[model samples]
Target chain A: MPHLPPLLAKPVDIAPLWLVERVARMIFSCVLKAHPDLFARLGDYRESRYCFSPSDLQLHFRVVPATQALSVSRGTPPPADAHIEGPIALLLGLLEGRCDADALFFSRDLSVSGDMEAMLALRNTLDDSAIDLPRVIGSFGGPFSPVVTGFARYIRTRVLEGRETAWN
Target chain B: MELICPAGTPAAFREALEAGADAVYCGFRDETNARNFPGLNFSREELRQSIALARRKNVQTFVALNTFMRAGDEALWYSAADDAVALGADALILADFGLMAYVAERYPQQRLHVSVQASASNPDAIRFLVETFNAKRVVLPRVLTVQDIARLTSQIDCEVEIFVFGGLCVMAEGRCSLSSYATGKSPNMNGVCSPASHVRYREEGGSLVSELGAYTINRFGSGEASGYPTLCKGRFDVAGAEGYTFEDPVSLDVIDEIDALRAAGVSALKIEGRQRGRAYVAEVVSVLKKALGATSAERAPLVSRLRTLSEGQRTTSGAYDKRWR
Candidate 1:
């Protein structure tokens, strides 16, 4: 997965932090509703605090599975049990289990710190759950499901375009 | 030769079978098998369902009860063997001598394949397993050259299985204690080598320092590809020169040596990584399946793609040719 253009982040960069944080919370709620057992496979690490910091964006999201809460901030987030930093596209690809985390890490495209086991457990759990972001986002749109799904898919395609998920 | 693939999950098993695996090997989610990582492996019900699907597709299913049993805990491994057999596994891939003996006496008709953990390289070792437990096949350790394999095949009575792709551990398989010395966990006992729980990566002086417990395994400069600190593949300062002293961080891929392996009388080719995702399983299975059926020249590009999938985007023929000393 490639990094997004600065132009794509222009509008979001200008948007107020509260508005962005609210939107992130709403999306997180939608994801949780779609995959109730998402953190079930995490087992002992279910309580670990996970931080996702997208290098291309100003936003950082933190999640503590024990609380089932997603909080977003403009600057550095609080201390986490595990934290992963990468391009927003790569982060999304990993969320959808479309990108190979090991491959991405091996190639130095992503950087992770803190508990490796907790992060690996999360990765495996996510991969097995088969999270479809477009579908999940669309499911919340009611009558506008198809249009929402199409737009999400189109954006995802553009982000992942020419990047074969195969290898290298 | 049969194409045997590994499946840690049902989704991986389905992908392997769908990608044209002749046999798919999996393990129960416990200490009974190797690659016993969190959020991985199959439950009893999952194994039962997977075996049924493989049988319907006419593909063999091998259950890996490959870990050694601990004292007073033999019952756990023993029960796993019974459950795997009861689920109609085409073969039980086992490494424990006591468990193998138990299976031999109780389920005489069930087929047994010596796991790589057994490290049965010599004719005598192979003969011992085959003679005592009637093991139909033996998965050779990753320390044999093609010539060594050919010679062993010429002398042994049972079929030979060799690792053709995936994670490479260059130690004397199942006998190494480096992981335990660092993490107090070894694959033979706990089904993990350099267990992730003890692994940590830290930024130090513009380099990424990967450590296994208190021991620093390797340091990677900016933008350099890196792999897990599996001790065997870690870099260390030896004779005042720092480099990969044991083995480099690379995966084992012998796609180019298919003809040589075949001529060496390998009865089955195995792709490792039971802990990998289904996409990895699917890609490796499909490409290798094509290579097995294609001419040598047609295998070139496929081999190239496989290297990209290898750990750290680097690969080796490993001990297959004995080129590295």
Candidate 2:
């Protein structure tokens, strides 16, 4: 197996799964609150916003760090401002800056629902931010390399286990 | 009374027909069909030719258009239905409700057989399909026992086709997302499960590790035989347990149970594995055709002869006996 980068090594149990997801959401909300220009391209003056949907076992965060966000589920789709719905691997690929939003959208991995401009704003915002998972691990005094590596390992393990997504 | 066999390709179709299959079931080469492998299934022209050939042999051809339709891409499925009807298919096997509705509404003259992908386990669901869409036959999922099959036959108006031999899916059909979760492609969405596109085999430290996508599904030493990587049958570790957690690698061989199945009112005996070669089709078909005629006492010896050809050299009655559950 190849080595996983430090960014993906964070352990799931560092906090509750819900808290970990909520923390990621809070980070995005704070980033949007601090820098409105970051999201300007993603939204218009009338439709500047962020959308988040947390299922019982999965958390989805689509933010317009600059303008608009859209969300969709299996049967229901939210208004398309910034759209993203995917298994954890694809979602992680988008959030970790490892994948381009355009590739995911074109490949039909992550679907878009609302205004393309607003969706782009949210995608760009999420793509540009450096979430600094290692720093978060260090503050908690956990093994940074091992955690990120473990998370990546878990992804690889569960993928083999035939679990598909990172949700229940 | 009909022996419907699966044909992954034209060669398999020929093999099944020559082996005395009364009817052969196959799919198109595209995503409209379920066995969406590279060299498997018939093209439109090939299907047209195969239908004519089967007709000469007095064997019917059923086209499997079993995949679920995506939100924006109902056109592909719609066109497939039109093509199947135009090409003179004996029947159209379908699972999707919207697509079933489309076929029912668009080509009412064409016969409809319900694919096991719908997971319609109950009599009510079967009756609904029969009453609403006029399904002529239904391939029941492997989750039901012989008693269940008998009960279902007593209740439903349509004919039932039971899988008698070939690969056994331990998981309930259409309900599993293990393949889609590992690889982005899915049987429900893309008409394939554990597709070869994402499979990788590597020799490491004198042992072979088989991977699906990026995850290792199986590892075997030089002495061990490697099996195909199906999620439900794959060995895994969960809660400090390691081994075949769901099901051991095996095939479903009910060669000896043909009499029981006949007694239970099974209209057709199906052999799975459209991905298999023509030789496999011929061998399995010949054995099954003979077994279909043999008495219960005579079948034991024939079933024993078929043991070596079975996957992993082991077979299960597989939900036919409720104790296996």
Candidate 3:
């Protein structure tokens, strides 16, 4: 697990489910614009609903694709075409191709249910692109872009160093 | 010491030979090889071409029929052995006792190297494999410390091959059943661990999540890089403490201990990662080739270069350093 700055960690741990959901919706809205090709490929999932759950934070989101926008809900929206669950870091890793999907799944770090073809398509698409979350998020910060980038770099460094210390 | 490397494709096989690998190991594109990932491995025709290429360069070619044979599917593995010999491979790397027996009896003139999947760590076990299957060399499992390996080397009759670098498996190679329990596919039986068809990733509540089958193996905080989730390397909550319960997500790297390993009577140094691409194989083989020839002072920089390619951006001496115990 990645180590969070104590100040940020506490608030996040205590944050309400609704707030978390709202933030996810906003970030994903920007993400879809940044990678239109990725969302376009998800056209096969047009009528499908997918559920994503982060177990540690006890948060979940139901996602559906519309013609131009994605509809996301905080609580159980409906029966999903596929369900994916794990930790926040791994989900991001899959998007960025920083983590190997097969390796994580083999270790039982991540899981998926229903619609195997949809899942494979998503995986292959992500693997083909370089989706850096920090850069994507920072792209929207305008004047604060440098600050956002710096903070993201710092947090990433801290997490990597902590993991190295623990493992080595 | 001989430097052995892995080649998943015919292109990688040629790359390894050109990059100074003393020998290159590869397998057919089937369940017969441990790295049975899609789009990887060679067909029989490809292997024949690869062997011919290695012959011209005077480099050895070893075929790995390392996965264990299922009871009803022995013919598939048996045919792999027969074809590898027919293709004039320099040696055969085998893991199963029955397959070993079959190869030993039919092809007495062929050389055999015991695969690491056999998990033969001790001298007695190594000796048994040598006597029973006529294994000329044994690839030691990654569980032994340097001193333990040195001790075993002194007693064993055959040559010993040690993994010098690449991905680390915390569990005993052939004995691990964690994948089978969750995925219904065993590396020993199906030649894959954590098959990709079962992996899924999702975004929830501002956090990204990764899962395998029905299990939530790990969670990462925002901005943290996630690692491949092998069961042993995943973090878990044990007794209110949340951390890695078995092993951490780190690759094995023992370049710093080359002198010690050489002194310990290791005859060959193996580099893992057949599932990796030709570029990875080429870069690693080139650097390690220089390191193998360099003096102690010259090796430090070369070792650092290889670290950038490690699995988790972190490297460990693994069991070579007893502190890990």
Candidate 4:
């Protein structure tokens, strides 16, 4: 392996897994609210457990979607129906269509395992339902919403700049 | 000129055909093709069906057996070519010299195309493939200017295809080893570069960092758009200057250069996203189809729309414009 810069050798925590899950649940809930048919389009796999593992963060989330409700918990479920694992930046890019899902998967930057149909459905649904994380988080006008949005923006900027600078 | 598009799956194949693609190119679900992503590509049955569908619509189906063959795994690539031919592929796009020779000898009647993965940029290299393998067309690598293409077209005997849109590889095709150096997988042999299995992202000091293998490709700031962590597109510090040292994380959009390409005696316009989804295939093909027939005045808005679909919201003509060199 090539030498990584000394500044990037150590992992830093901008937010904990629990905080990320909590914010993810809130953001997904808002996404569901805006696009009511989003989860419905998931068909029979609406209740399936999906695992998202951010390799660098050493964190994983088991996401479950019930009718009109979405839950994200830290760590994997006992038996996940599908797993989408990648860098958090690429995962977020998948949501916003900023990153090419195929490019990530082709370059081996993203991996999907288990339920192929469910994964495809999830991918198509995400592609169809436009998701803007900052906009959604910022829309939650409450005492803590600004803090959430600020943190989200901070993370977004760092990841994006990292991605942009890494190559171009 | 023909509009050749990429289709990673059956649905995307159908989408491209429906969206006015003159031909659709794809690969089998394995490492035989360059865009070897998991959960993508077509199975044998799917390819058969897709070809039938394309035939029904009067659109050609080209099978990409473009990945280089390992010495011991020669049969695998030969089998891929046999299967592609048996499945009624209109043409076989190939890269390996041995595989090309094998296909040329085995299926003498099958139409053969030189893949961009061959990196036959100059007239001499391209002429060698055309004369040796009887390749009918050659997909030019994204390293030549429109003028360079025009010059090569005048010198080469076979048809020339150039990438018009989608992801851009900064390095020369078939020669880049950055991904293999960072990750064990080789795009030539394994049909993947910067494989997803080797990528990781971490947050350090409020900055988000993307790593491919053990190398830190880039670090991002707050609210910035993140691009994919391909080795070629990553930002790096060269002599203390922090920026993309090789190339930017930008997509190649040559919609505005259609006339230049057409004038250059180009045979076809190729879209580069086979690993993309059906919606992307439909959207991009639909726009390019319109652009093909629209006037310059009518194309400005369409070009802007394409920019929205580019990587990191950025697009370039790449080496198509001489200024980039």
Model 3: residues with Cα > 4 Å off, grouped in runs: A1-168, B205-207
Residue A108 in model 3: shift from native, Å? 19
**lDDT tens digits, residues B1-325, model 3?**
9999988766567768888999999998789978866556778888898999999999999999999999998999999999999999999998999999999999998999999998889888999988988899999889989899999999989999999898898778988998888788777888887765565566566444656677776775654545565677777889999998887767889888889999999999999988765555777788888899999899988778566556655688888886833
Candidate 4 segments whose C-alpha is farther than 4 A from its true place: A1-49, A52-168, B204-206
Tell me, by lDDT, which candidate is best. Answer: 1
DockQ of all models, two decimals each: 0.49, 0.01, 0.05, 0.06
Which consecutive 10 residues in model 2 chain B have the weakest lDDT in total? Answer: B305-314
* Regions more than 4 Å wrong, model 2: A1-168
Reference-based TM-score, model 1: 0.95
CAPRI classification of candidate 2: incorrect
Q: Rank the models by DockQ, top first.
A: 1, 4, 3, 2
Error of 4 at A40 (Å): 21
Return the DockQ of model 2: 0.01
Tens digits of per-residue lDDT for model 3, A62-135: 76655433344444544777777766666666665555454454335666767754665455445435466788
Per-residue C-alpha lDDT of model 4 across residues B2-50, encoded as one tens digit per residue:
9999887676787788889999999987899998765567779889999
- lDDT tens string, model 2, B1-325? 6788888756568778898999999998778876776545677987998999999999999999999988898999999899999999999999998999998998888999999888888999999999899898999999888888988898888899988888787666777898999999888888888886676655578565667887888776654545566777777888888888777767888777777788889999988877655545666788778888888888778767444445555678888876833
What value does DockQ give for candidate 1? 0.49
lDDT of 3 at B213: 72
| Docking level of model 1 | acceptable
Error of 2 at B267 (Å): 0.5
